[model samples]
Target: MDHKAAKRRKLTDKSLPNVILQNPDFAEDSQMYQSLLEMERKLDWTITRKRMEIQDTLSRNPSTTRTLRIFVSHTVSGQSWQAGTESDNLTHSETGENIPAWQLKIEGRLLELPQRGKDKGPPRKFSTFIKRMMVEFDRDTNVYPENNIVEWPRATGHHNPPLDGFTVRRTGDVPTHIRIVMYLDHYPEQYRLNPDLSSVLGIKEESLLGVVQALWNYIKIQGLQDKADRRLVRSDERLRAIFGVETIPFQKLPEYVKRLLSPPDPILLHYSFDPSLPVVEPERPTAWDVEIKMEDAALKNRMGVMLHTNKETSVALAKMDEEIALLAQSLHNSHLKRTFLQSFADDPAKFIQTWLESQSRDLESVLGAGASEGLTLRQEELRRSEFFRLPWVEEAVSVQEGLRLASKGM
Candidate 1:
């Protein structure tokens, strides 16, 4: 009875906390948890910093849209014949002596719409809003649109400079009507596809994004993707002719497709200028309507509201994240304590003996003491055929083989 009482006292003296505190693996795991928590905090701070930077940039450059109007006018100005010695013999009866010169004027303006409930009047027009305008003529003309056309910000005028108008002297051999091409800022440019591309896409003109999407669809339908590598495309006969290659990389499709695209054909407009009529008629200037992509003010306002972060909400979120991290750490510590106590409660003496043996083995390994002897003993035990014949060994091998086969199948 005395011996049994001494054994019980010895087991009771070895507490669960002492055993856990001495474990090297548990200490290493705790340090790793601390490092992970620190990394998470740094990651959260980086995300918040980036978000704030984006918000600041968005606030500085708020997007807005404006309406642009293109105006064109045609008028005829008569030039009287000067008293010259060369044409003195020519009879005044002939109409060739006095010829009328026709002039075509092209100008543009930006219109500002009134506020919803504040102003009730016609849209205000401004000439300074036009950043750049390019006008191209169908045939050769005397006057050309100026290069790098820019309007004065403070200039007050009915028309923008450099693109006011053009005058033509000879009209006998020239075509009756002409085609004018205009490109405006803040507008989506359209492209016309070549015959081969058009045949494949079934579209003559479309936006660049639309063309790319259509090409992607065609590739999907034709199954032109390479079997071995998805990034490469096996071009069909039609695509081969268009791209000039049997196989093409998917990324280079856009560069090759751009070669097959051209600007859309110019629109034709006819004008009849009468010298007898007044220069400024009631319906003198002809206007052509064009569609422009504008920034949505309502959508922008919504985005602004979303981007406007509340200081209180941000503080609350940060506090919540910190609290959650603390709770997670507390939970992890509680779990470790619970596992230690449960093992001790199952069999106190056995748990204490096993824990002390494990710690001694770890200490010996760390100090490089008696490691060769332990390694030799383990090798001798493993070398015996009886070790492989154990029931648990077969079960472990079966489980490992099953996991490997499952991974390969996946």
Candidate 2:
């Protein structure tokens, strides 16, 4: 198959759990496919019906009604561009280094009711405006590609492109900005209740629901409707603090609720180089590291699924051995990080010395084994050996020992 065809197939393939992938028998299980198909059909029908109902409502009353909603999505592009690859894609022209890019999409809609004239208290004409924007970003080395944004149905299409007035802008060097956007886009628990709001209502701030959803839930729970009219909300102590009045027209509640939200604090991106400023190292692994960890996890899961499939099979047993070895190495690295790295955080010099010593010890063992067999270590062997005595190692060791002694005396 051609590269493009293969890539398309890989992209379109249904992502099965590690178990199903490891066990092809399960992948082709007719019963499983049928069940999934049936569930998908039912969900589609239910969603289609609900959407139609919403459209009907909007069409019936466009003048005074509107839906205030925002949706975010992310997509990963495997394509990369080298510097000076202007013909291929927009990229840096200097170093010719490959630049990685991904896309983020944000969509929002607003419905406005305008006052026509003195005779008309409020405009009867409704204006519904929908906008969507897609932004491309250089994915941070620590960002996971699996966090790719999936398409959702909007209007008559799935995975719709950016709408009118959409534009792309580059951000500061920090990749966390992109990471944050992706996180906010796909966060599963979106609607956690705010503490201040919860206190006013005398309820615990529960699930991670958005402010709008949380407020709606609070209103429903309180049952604080106007005595004479159900269309109005009668203010209690909490509602009074919220609405600043004893009553709020049901239609205006949304407006008031929105007012309570404080805008998020701005993130600092640009900074002038200052030699006086202390250098701060990254606190955690980058997206690239995270992607590798995820791959390792998937491999482990697949291995387990294979083992469970048919433990007697020679192929499965051999795969299990290989997976076990890989897992062991991963565990060793994790252990070292948790052990020495955390302990020497405050003393980086000591950390470096200790790490070098550890490497030296391992190398010594390898060299000793080679010598025991009457084999002379070559230049390549010496270079690769951690314990191969070097001038820099001696100097670092001396400095580390002196520092340790000085600290003890002090």
Q: How large is the C-alpha RMSD of every model relative to the true structure?
A: 19.6, 35.1
Q: Write the per-residue lDDT of candidate 1 for residues 18-77, one digit (tens) a residue.
A: 333566556666776558546756765675676676577465444445556667776553
Best-performing candidate as measured by TM-score: 1
Q: What would the per-residue lDDT of candidate 2 be over residues 1-410, giving only the tens digit for each residue?
A: 32322332343342222433464554465466548546746765665565565556444332222233333343333233222455656545475323444334444433322542232233221111321112323344354454323222224344554352222322222333432221221112222234566576444422223455656667778888767898888877866765679888887765775555442322111111222222355222121100000012223344445324354565664565455446545644554565465556446566776775576566667766643342344546645867636676677677667777889999
How many residue-pair clashes does candidate 2 contain? 15
What residue pairs clash in candidate 1, if any at all?
Answer: none
Give each model a TM-score.
Answer: 0.41, 0.23
Question: Residue 78 lDDT in model 1?
Answer: 42
Residue-level error in angstroms, candidate 2, position 279: 16
Using alpha carbons, what is the TM-score of model 1? 0.41
